[model samples]
Target: MEDQFFELMCEKSSSESANTSGRTEEFLDSSANTVDISENEEERDKMTNFLQVIESYTDQEFRRNFRLNSSTARMLIDRYNTSSFYTNKEHGGLPKVGASKEIYILLSYMANTNTFREIANLFNMSKSSAWRILRRVVEWLLSIGHEYIQWPSASKVQDNMRKFKAMKNIPNFVGCIDCSHINIKAPVSNKHAYFKRKQFYSPQLQVVVDADKMFIDVFAGEPGSLHDSRILRRSSIYEKATDDVESKFPFNSFLLGDTAYGNSQGLISAFRENGFLTPA
Candidate 1:
């Protein structure tokens, strides 16, 4: 009776082992069949994330966050797509973040001057990714900046003459010139050079704007400590003015400016009375 019981137990164990082996083989077969679906799943996930980035915001929210209307932002994206430098390619080797989100990130950075970590937190991306997006977008924008901001041609300047004089009986006026300091953190190199008379660190941004407030030219990267006159002298516009004001601009056309600027053949400053210029 004992020998018969031991043989029965051995047979039961062998049957259970075969059943377990068969189950393992079935699971492997199922896994192999499903392996190709992972790529599709990844693509779906990317689309979901992209939609989530844009779908929640209205046009008003987009404008508030980016300082540009939704229409303008869309136009910029289209321009970037067609641009030879930025065309539908990811040359930076970074993972794909949707184009809309990338534009939003750049505009957010520019509009609010937010720090990189803050942008990363708001946009749900890594800090390094945010920085990479900003760097590439800024470089691309700089490359195309000349197309947007340029000196008006001789004919265009002549056309705007009447409109400019309408401001304050200032005839033959072309535009206004001014410089303002933009605050910045102390740089690792040349910290003292960036320190301004106002006891802050900054770089001076000199701008030439038409009476209609459209930018005609801009020069930046000058140390805040430099005088406005020194900055003006260093500008390419000033070089052009000094070279031959008559050939470059409309006959007798002059730029309007405050006392901070000097009186040149092409640039004119409002006359000062006593301590300051009159509001009139």
Candidate 2:
């Protein structure tokens, strides 16, 4: 009888040990699942907050931050959506960013000097993703730039001339030409060529604007160390004007430029004062 009791106790202890092991495994699994769910909720909340912050901005604030009004931003988003480049995935990988968000990211990059990492964090994306979106958006805008920026038609030139005459009492004035310096990092080749008088490395952008301050022509990629006259001579507009002034300056109109541009067939500059001019 004592031997039978000892065997029964051993069996009972074995059963209890197996049950405890099973309960421990179940608890560990439940804890792991809880951690996963918590992480997912946190990510969702972050996205929600990011979107809400943007949506709550006023019109002025939106323009200040994005460099464009909300309506114009929406229009760009719609336009981007119509292109083949607009997609939510690449071969069924992680979902791609939407058009609206991509545009905002591009504009933010343009309107500020924020680093890619900062921009990515603000938009809830990775640095590489921000770079990719910028490349796509910039290429799209460049592809369509010619449609918006071009020499005025003959009639349009005449209209612009009239506006210039009325505004500044200058006859046959069609547009204003000027140069601006854009800061850039030192290039690996010919670093000195990009260093300007302002003690920084940069590139120069030459633009022609009509009376309405709308860009009619843009020429860039010249080193900042170069003079305005040299940049102008290197431009296609100069080549065309020098070849056939009538082709570019219809109605005998001319562009007003600063002294840096000197004088040309289709351009006029202010006379330098030497402090020896007699009253005429």
Candidate 3:
């Protein structure tokens, strides 16, 4: 499981180039001169349908949260051009799912502990399809979103003082990495060999994220049985550092990890030995 998780992490691209124009302020003002009203309305309805599929969130609830209405939804959907619903076919990319995106629908329902069967019933998809879509969306977010996260520069560090909670002389920390687990169904009878104890428990990454909930360095992807330290040892980020001749924070830079990570010159753990606490 540790090896597989590491493999997935390695699948993460190192590319940083992302089209910011499609997502930010420029989107806000794209509505005014955008002539075609029907096209815009179709896009809006897709988003609204998308929103409706996310269980437990009603139209009233969405309006309350976003401070917008049915009318505003049109502008928003137009601005949020990621959906293919209203795109002119001559433009590019695959077509929209016609109904709300199955991916969106699955994620919306995933916020809680809805069974695969229940989710499938609600979305009119097979349980396997629902699960597959959930995994793909997660991969997309981890791939694109993780790369686009720029570290807070020294110039912005002062402005971000609020994200920090000073400890000793150290300021806001990026993270104190940890791992957690979720319940999962056991494998089928003949596939028992493929199931590990951790396979019955899905891992969740926990990082003491900064203001943006972005990881400074410490991150999680270990199996339930693997120590956080061992996870770090096998991580591609660590591999890149240890193997790179020009890496900035070589093995000399300090990091904080779980008690399982222990203490090293370059890695700090809040350790307590024989009832005596060790100072950082």
For candidate 1, lDDT tens digit of each residue in 1-280?
Answer: 1011011101112333243234323322332343332222222111225336665679888667666677777766787666664544555685566666777777776778776656666776666567667655655555554545567788878766888777677789888889888776665456698899899877677777766666667676667899998988987678878897876577689888898777886898868678665676
Write candidate 3's Cα lDDT for 17-76 as tens digits. 122212211221222123222222222111233345443556677445433343434432
Worst 10 residues of 3 by lDDT: 1-10
When sorted by lDDT, best at the front, the candidate numbers are 2, 1, 3
Question: Relative to the true structure, how large is the alpha-carbon lDDT of every model?
Answer: 0.64, 0.68, 0.40
- The TM-scores of all predictions, comma-separated, are 0.75, 0.79, 0.53
The window of 10 residues in a row where model 2 has the poorest summed lDDT is 2-11
Error of 1 at 74 (Å): 1.3
Best by TM-score: 2
Candidate 2 residue lDDT tens string, 1-280: 1011011101112333243234323322333333222222223212425556877899888878766677777777898888876776653376567788887887777778666656766887656567667766755555455545667888889999989989988899889999888776665556698899999876677778888777677676677999999989987668768898887898889999998878888999977678976754
> What clash pairs does model 3 have?
none
* Best first by TM-score, ranked: 2, 1, 3
- Candidate 2 TM-score, true structure as reference: 0.79
